[model samples]
Target: MAIKVLVVDDSALIRNLLGEIINSEADLQLVGAAPDAFVAKQMVKQFQPDVITLDIEMPKVDGLRFLEVLMSARPTPVLMISTLTEAGADATIRSLELGAIDFIPKPKLGVAQGIEEYRSVILEKIRTAARSRVKTQRTKVKATSHLSYSSTEKIIAIGASTGGTEAIKSVMEAMPPNAPATVITQHMPPGYTSTFAKRLNNCSKMKVVEARGGERLLPGNAYLAPGDRHMRIVRSGADYRLELHDSERVSGHRPSVDFMFQSLVKSAGSNVVAALLTGMGKDGAQGLLALKQSGAFTLCQNEESCVVYGMPRAAVQLGAADKVLPLEAIPEAMIQQLEKVKAGSRL
Candidate 1:
């Protein structure tokens, strides 16, 4: 059966173009094109689409409000249509927190050509969304275990995509203020990572900032891979520094989890505790396996806790994860992993 999709945008042009795109694919079916929330509500009831493409700046009720209500009521997988501007990025992240499956940015240049260029990505995101779990917004759950990792010898690495922003927030905020240095690569477009880092910093006990290469990896601080750029860890004297690379995309993403994971395997794998979280592809699977083989403690978010169980699922399949855990349990697991590594015992 074709995956049913609904286009919900105020713009007639967008609705038509997106409709055409869906119809062009034999595996996708256009269930409805709604111009506003009122019409969208009726269409949603009438068609019960498997996936929905939502615009943030919809008339009257805005996408976020609609999403909150929808998630609370119907809880369906939704892909937000967002722009690349600061405001757009903020709204896009907010939508993800409200239980949206993922987002696709609007073209920056020629609308038709730009969107056409992203045709494959858009289709892939839609297909992934269709298979995604629409997670409910639960009260923030903080880690209950005591965290005491204060050594510069320990490193924590994380890789995520799709539903990662919220997942990252959950774990980061639960970390202790003096936690080990952390590195992250969350699949995102250029110009969005800065905003994301700032958001994470605000809620997290540790400082979080966008990686700009050559920054010392300090305890209680987290470095986020700059969007579209690869991040690597390098040892300088007695300390580690985060470095950025302009190399070609690895595992289909520039800031690939695999790229970051493999770099740690070469330098500090034994001292690292890496976790692969919710995403829509196998970008981090091989790299995670390498980390595990290099003696790093690796973790994969369990399928039930994942919004899109692609990356972590791949890691689990490859036997890359030392433990498969739920999203909420990962922080405690990381701390435990660090203790085991510190004691130099895999047991």
Candidate 2:
């Protein structure tokens, strides 16, 4: 049986283009293409698509409003087709919070030409979305950060891909104001990571900013890797400062989780605590293993809590994670490890 897909966009060009791509894949079937949310709602009820690709800026009923309703009522996997602008990025983040599995960044230029360059990427995201877990988000009372450890020397490194924005928010919001300096790398494009950082900052007690090379890592703050740059933790005398690299892609991502974790292996391995969260590929596996080998306390989100278990599964297969935990359990677990490491250092 082929995976059923529904394309919902106000533009006929996008709908037709996506239809063509879905039809090209033998394992994928295009169930319907709707020009607006009303038509999309009808198609969704009529075809019962396994996956939906929604344009964020749709006419009449917008994608976010429709997504909220669908999640409350139908709860199907959704992937937003978003413009790569700053505004688009902000809306995309909001969509993720509302239960979207992932997003497809629309080409800023010629539709056919720009999309042609990302043909493989577009298809892969669709397939990934099809397999993702879809559930309406539960309202959890925010956990106050109880991180009591005050060592600025300890570094927390986190990486995720698909379903990451929400996961990252979940972890960050629970962190206490006094938590150790943290670095996060979520596989995102350029304009989006900045928006993501801003969003996190609004909810998190710790100050969160996009990493821009040479900034010293400090306790009570978090740094997000720039979307286009590979962020590395480097020893600057006695301190750890962020370094951004415009190097070639590693493990198929520019600001790859693998590169970030592997970089820490040489710089602060023994003092680092890392977590590999829900993602669609094995990008963070080898690097997490390397960090574990270098004496870091490493964690991977358990399959039960993951939207896509590919990345964490790889780490588990490699014997990388010290603890395979649920999303709600990871933040406190990370802080506890920090406390343990701190106590051991004192001894």
Candidate 3:
């Protein structure tokens, strides 16, 4: 069966255009259209849509408020339709925090096929969204054993995939504004990661930004690995820096979590916090183990709060995770671990 989609926008022109794009794809079907969030809520039950395309601006409640309520109540996958302007970017990022799966910039109705640029991405997002299964409230369970750590500027490396959109969000949201300079690898397409980084920057207190070559890893700044390249941390005497490499895809992933974690072990030795989040594969398992062998603080997401427990499960099986906690506690645990390092305590 085709993936059922509902397009919600105040403008009838935008609704019709989106309907056209979705209907053109054989795998996607436009089940319904709504002029605002209120109408969209009713249509959701009426149409039983697998995915919803939501506009951020509307007459009544607006998109962000609606998205929050929807995720808290119905928990359906939603794709944001936003303007390309600065305001749109801000709102788009906010929507993602509220559990929106992905987004497309607003189209210019004047130009021919202006809306078509988003057709491919929209369909792709819908397909991916339909497959996702993020829950309303994240769970955070404590680990059975205590993981050792100390107060030093250890290099932290993380990785995620599949339901990582919300998985990463929970982790970052729980972190302090002045957290460690962290690096992350998430499986996402080009242009998307940039937007994802921007979204994270807005929602999280930490400085979350897209990775660039040779940028210094500063305190409290979290760099996201670019889509096409692998991000590795290079030690420069006392300070740390980022290296964007086009190395062979490890475990079929360019920004492979294992690749970054393993490289950190070789460069920073045991001075690292290696984490594996919710994903569909075992990409980070072996690398996290490497970090553990080298004495790095290792963590993984437990099944309760994960959208899919595959990646973290693999890491646990490999004995990579020193502690496996629920989603809400990971950030707090990270902060504690980093404080231990800063205090110069023994691991």
Clashes of each: 0, 1, 8
TM-score of candidate 2 versus the correct structure, residues matched by position: 0.97
Candidate 1 local lDDT, 234-332, one digit each (tens): 887778888899999998999999999999998897888999999988999999999999988999999988888999988999999999989999998
Residue 222 Cα positional deviation in candidate 1, in Å, after optimal superposition: 0.3
Whole-model lDDT for model 1 versus the true structure? Answer: 0.89
Where's the lowest-lDDT run of ten residues in candidate 3?
143-152
Per-model TM-score versus the true fold: 0.96, 0.97, 0.70
- Candidate 3 to truth, TM: 0.70
Q: How many backbone clashes are present in model 3?
A: 8
Question: Order of candidates by TM-score, top first?
Answer: 2, 1, 3
Tell me the lDDT of candidate 2.
Answer: 0.90
Best by TM-score: 2
What lDDT score goes with residue 157 in model 3? 74
Runs of candidate 1 with Cα error greater than 4 angstroms are: 138-140, 144-146, 343-347
lDDT of 3 at 137: 56
List candidate 3 stretches off by more than 4 Å: 10-29, 58-61, 105-124, 137-153, 161-180, 186-213, 218-221, 225-230, 245-259, 279-295, 308-323, 332-347
lDDT of 1 at 272: 87
